[model samples]
Target: MSKPRKPKGRPVSGWLVLDKPFDFGSTEAVSKVKWLYKAQKAGHAGTLDPLASGMLPIALGDATKTVPYVMDGRKIYEFTVAWGEERNTDDLEGEPTQTSDKRPAEEDIRALLPKYTGVIEQVPPQFSAIKIAGERAYDMAREGETVEIPAREVEIHRLTLLKAETDQAHFEVECGKGTYVRSLARDMGRDLGCFGHIAGLRRTLVAPFGEERLVPLEKLVALEEIEDVEERLAALDAFLIPPVEALTSLPHVRISDDQVRRLRAGNPVILRGRDAPLPTPEAYATSISGELVAIGAVEEGEFRPKRVFG
Candidate 1:
């Protein structure tokens, strides 16, 4: 019999909240983080365009299992909309497809906020990651093929205009998953009779992670200068937040050591006591010592393991 190939790199696990710099692609950022950490596996919670800068939560090793939880969380973005021209891609990266000389007044912009604040249908930018007929939309867009992209509902929790200028406007938005800020600028421009595109965009928050947890790429790169390999790895490891941090929005249960062993072995552990939680579709279990053990479901007073952590 042939031997199984072992995975390379350390089995390090945790979340690295990177303050991605402008012009950096999300996939590229993940590669860099994985290489720096020398981890066996790594993945990012959400995709951020090259022109966009901000919080890009990266998961390494076993933490990759919790990425879906973080990606589903609310996001906050601060962006600047440059009026007078609208681009094909809906951002500054694309060629101008439409132009208008009219500038919207501050009152006019404020009046338009209410319309976009609630759940509304939005057409994603043509140059986006959305797939069409099994091909990426951005790839088709780059080939000069314009396809009819359907509009879908996206919830905007809050949209606030912070400043307005003669040719540009700055705003901050808190929105749900899959909401595109680029589309916001494009649609608002068309409504106000002034063409617009995103000139600057920065993500400030992603659910459980906030600006406080963000570590700039440069700061992490600097740790590479440490003389000893072990010390350098330790320094890099210091920035990793616990994997449980990403599951803050989900129901959590602390189990006994015996329960932890059962859960890790892919067995259900009965919940005992009057205060036991009711049935839930999803929840995470931790050891009595507070270490993440497994993500599972609670049903009929039993915690059934779905994804056990190593």
Candidate 2:
């Protein structure tokens, strides 16, 4: 019989809320973190553009399993919309596709805010990750192909105008997943009789993770200078937030050792006691010692394991 191939690197597990710097791509950030930690597995909850800087939640090892939860959470962004010119990419990176001499007044921009709030249809930018016929939109855009992109619904929980300049306006927004700030800038300019594109963008929060948890990329790089290998790795590991932290939004239950064993074995465990939680669509079980055991559903007084964790 052939032997099973063992995975490489350390089995480090946790979430690293990275304060990603401008011009740093999300995939690049994940690769940098993985190389620094030498972890066996790593993934990010969401993609942050190279032009944007802010909270990027990265999962190491077992924490990768919980990425979908973080991705589904709301996001908050502070952005600058520069008027008078709209680019194809919807940001400064692309050439201007349309231009106008007019700039919107503060009162006019404020009046436009309500129109963008709540559930509204939005069209993504040409230079977006959205796929068309199994190919990336950005790929087609780079090759000079202009394809008709469809509009879809996105929720903008709140949109606030912070400051307005002669040719630019600063704003903050809290929105649901898949919402595009660049498109907001583009559409708003069109409605205001001025063309616009994103001049700057910085994410302040991703639901469940805020600026408080952000660890700068520079800090992690500094630790690499430690003389001893173990000490360097320990310094890096200290920045990791527990994987359970990512599951705070979900219903949770602490189980006995017996229940933990059964959950790890992919078996259902019966709920006990008067305080046991009511049936839930999704919940997570932790060992008596407070370590995550599995993500499961509680139905008919029993917890059925879905994804077990070590």
Candidate 3:
């Protein structure tokens, strides 16, 4: 008997902002999406813990180049802190290492908000993906190794006490890259004298994409179940957000076809447009038809191609 043919994956390119479900790791989520789309290449902007559920932006093909932009973008998360217990992982996933009977009042919780706001020094959780001397901290931690994580500066644009119950408190934080909500909860508990760990977490927004564009895993799985490959591919494309959308944060300049060809050929070209004399150091160069040609820097009014895209 002849063996069935393996799928010759499609050259899919675009972004899929997945509403990652609880108990699913970011890598698993990416693999599921990539299989559903039958994409040749795939990657995720950032990771969401298996205990956390929220936006996990998966990039395919050319979109992978913009993963850094989305990862560096401001992020918004709503998480719940379960007061009275501290765990090894700083979240409910680990065993309880410490406990407290004290719980702070609403006003007490509110008063502490200011201290967590703005730039703050935070030590990442030992059970984190952070690399320590070429080894993953979490891997080392699980093997019973002592992990000493140094505190690093992280920006917290906003940290508010949304609601406080007797045993749990909800919070919403808008922060820059490197801020760990787990660490935030740990420190908050320490300050409140109650001890706490994250009970739940959800990411609502990652710049250029949010809840509005989030596609749940179930929908992608449904598409994957379809028997016809062509029909499946067509249906999946309907949900793709153009990879170029990731470049939305950067300045953009529309260039003529001749300039597009030159830029794609790795040549610098002088641009003529309203946003000319390119104020931003780097900008997305689009063609007359709005197709992305290259990512380049503005030098004396000339757009020098640094990374050209087809």
Best candidate according to lDDT: 1
Error of 2 at 13 (Å): 0.3
lDDT ranking, high to low: 1, 2, 3
Error of 1 at 137 (Å): 0.3
What's the candidate order when arranged by decreasing TM-score? 1, 2, 3
What is the clash tally of candidate 2? 0
- Where is model 1 more than 4 Å wrong at Cα? none
CA lDDT scores, all candidates in order: 0.95, 0.94, 0.90
lDDT per residue (tens digit) for residues 236-290 in model 1: 9999999988998878888999888889889999998876778998999998788
TM-score of each: 0.99, 0.98, 0.95
Q: Write the per-residue lDDT of candidate 3 for residues 1-310, one digit (tens) a residue.
A: 9999765787888999999999999999998888888898899988899999989899987788788889999999999999999999999889998999999999989999999999999999999999999999999999999898889999999998888899999999999998899999999999999999999999999987978999988888887778888898999988989888999988888899988888888999986767685456788888888887888788887889888877
In model 2, pairs of residues that clash are none
Model 1 weakest 10-residue run by lDDT:
272-281
- Model 2 TM-score is 0.98
* Top candidate (TM-score): 1
**Candidate 2 C-alpha RMSD relative to the actual structure:** 0.8
lDDT of model 1, residue 196: 95
For model 2, residues 1-310, the per-residue Cα lDDT tens digits are 9999899999999999999999999999999999999999999998999999999999999999999999999999999999999999999899999999998999999999999999999999999999999999999999999967899999999999999999999999999999999999999999999989999999999988988999999999999789899999999999999888888899988899988888999999999998788999899999878899999899999999999999
